[model samples]
Target: MKDRLSAFYWLHETQFAQISSNLITSQRRKAIDIFETEGFPTVRNEDWKYTSLKKLIAPNYVLPSPFASFDEEEQVEYKDIKKFLVNDIDCYQVVFINGRYSSWLSQTTHSKYDICTLGSAWKKYPKIVEENFNKLTKDDGPLVQLNTALAWEGLYVNVPKNIVVEKPIQVLYFTTGSTPVFNQTRSLVILAEGSSAEIIERHHSLTNHETWTNAVDEIQIGSNSSIHWVKLQHDSPQASLTQHSKINQEKDSKAIVHTISTGGKFIRNNLDFSLSGPGAEAHMFGLTLGNDRQLVDHHTRVDHIAPNCSSHETYKGIYDDYSKGVFNGKIYVHTDAQKTAAYQQNNNLILSEKASIDTKPQLEIYADDVKCSHGCTVGQLDEDALFYLRARGIRLKEAKALLMLAFANDAISDIQHPSLRVKLSQLIGRKLGVDMSTVL
Candidate 1:
């Protein structure tokens, strides 16, 4: 902790003035102060009880510098990463390498909507960026504050009023370096009234080097607008990821988010939704497939602050080979949030004797006329179902794989993109060492 603080202090002393010149300087200073006081979270923290950052903290990871020029080497690396992208789908692309925007590999548009980098937006239109930046995420937390203080570049998207973005926007982050590196990134998305958009975010590692990413995203859904967001996490086993997303919805707006976590060394996701206007709705779904000592933890919260709001959350996990998974979901209905409807569910499948899971689903409702329900289940594959498949002359390994895939498909089926769904199915099949050509 001392070493990390020293590094941060050095960076602040040198770069804080330059980075905070155009933006709110006091805000950045305040965030850094909070991080300096709180430091990294440990097991003692209630929200972090199920996960620890000891290993991540021990690494001497330095902040990566922005690339001055794109060379042949980076071009080759970009080509190698193309295989990991959703190529079949046409979309506006925003690529980030080592936390810095890469224009050579990115495709952005401005005719119908503003799809660009936060740095570019901040430079070209400081007033517009100032109006929305940091407005939604005002809470104080260690990781979030750190990102606020150090985040250099990330994607920025805006959908104008009554405009429907036909193509999905793809934000891809790739890590490549010889030494251990730490990256802090921030993204913002704003949809005008009556507009709709679809977004896909993904992370990948091009090298085996140890990398840690702390990312924060803030999204604002306008009145009567809608958005569908998908996050795909498939980094190298040596990568550690911590992501925090805050979403705010307006009257009659709808927001749906889907998260698929398949690869990582240690991953912790914190997702929060705020229904600020009446008749707002939110739907969240997540799937985690872990193996070989991987640890994945998801913590989600939904706040119904207005009347006639609704929310639904469903998370599923499949653990094998001593892997561990954790799910904690909370729903809060305020005193004035009458007629609120909320539901939460979590289910897990433990495939090995050493695999384990910890799940908690809770609801705290203060409104008298509200409907809320929460439940969780942790168990193994049904023996009867496996036997039923085996009785039809299916091999044991194939049968087990089939059952596991079927169990996870419930969550995958919720994805709205056909090509993305097929890609994820194939990735899951490869991870399980099974051939899903026929089933998928």
Candidate 2:
């Protein structure tokens, strides 16, 4: 895998030279060098102790080209992917097919605020791109460095001051599945002061062929602004994803992120938060449904660097059919970050005896005046509650489904989008082999 990546980089390195600025090109060069030096992570690495990249990287995947052209006779349209969209809610779309922008499937803008591709933004909005691009990620790993070195075209969103985007932005990335391919994507979102936005992002594969996606997102929240980011991970069983998201918040800003994972061969999410401004708050909620031999992990860190900042994190999982799950959350408070309030919890239910979960929650505080708590629980469904529901005339399958539904809803109850919540309920029910659309 290392040699393949090395050769691919030197061969396809010129694909980014035309679209990227000098700063970006320099960063790409340094990142590729670092990745080549370190190579893909292994279980020996402390950060990836529980997860293994051996199975994911052994496929000899082919790298995607930036100029890979689709056949003009077979173009993608909204009608082709209607089942993937939230049918009830209105949204602005940004679609990527095979790591390239698809204009026909995307509804973007330039007048109200820039919600377009980084390929154009690098040429049009150079200042904003230079200021926030690659600025949020300081602690880089091998996979992240790989993305930085190769990914060029992705979603670019910048909302100016005092503006509220009425419609939610739906960002979708799709794989054609014509061949086993490996791709990287980068997204940068900047919300100025007094502005707020809601976004829904998802990845899907049209075919069950092997696809590996390494994605990174950098979000900057200005003073008194808020951004809600919801990521729905329901891909084919052959698909694998490794996503790293970094969020930086300023004074009185709020950052909300949700990761709902149900289907994927192997999935890992890294969420990092930096509360650098006083009065800033960060909220994280995640729900993962694991079945079969799938693996899903969510590793999060929240750093309290300013005084009077607060953060809340909650993640829950339900596993069955020999699946495995992991959750590791850490909260750090600096000495100068007095009056910090931080709370974190991870809860999981293993329905099958062969299934398992590993959860670790940690908190480190140096401030004199701070409130911090961390806890985790791994258990099974309450037999008494299940029996009671069954005794009330509900079928056993429905009863178990209801219990799981109640358990998962707490993490996403505050999504603020009714249609999305309903759609999620449908997805959850389908995954559980029950009908729960009307229950939500």
Best by TM-score: 2
Model 1 gets an lDDT of 0.85
Worst 10 residues of 2 by lDDT: 67-76
lDDT of 2 at 292: 99
Best by lDDT: 2
The parts of candidate 2 lying over 4 Å away from their true place are 71-75
Candidate 2 positional error at 196, Å: 0.7
Error of 2 at 415 (Å): 0.8
- Whole-model lDDT per candidate: 0.85, 0.88
lDDT of candidate 2 at residue 51, scale 0 to 100: 94
lDDT per residue as tens, model 2, 1-440 = 88888777777677676677788878878888899989999999988999999999988686776656664422566776788887678899999876888898889998889899887888898777888888976458999988888887788999999999888999998876567878798899999998999999998877657888999999999999999999999998999999999999999999889999999899999999999999999999999999999999999999999999999998999999989998989899999999999999899999999888888887788899999988888888889999999899889898899999899988889899877888888889999999986676
Model 1 lDDT per residue over 349-439, tens place: 9989999999987678899999998888989889999999999998788788888888887787878888789888878888889887777
Candidate 1: worst 10 consecutive residues by lDDT?
Answer: 67-76
Runs in model 1 deviating more than 4 A are 1-6, 9-16, 19-23, 67-76
lDDT comparing candidate 2 with the true structure: 0.88
- TM-score of each model, paired residue for residue: 0.96, 0.97
Note the residue pairs that clash in candidate 2.
none
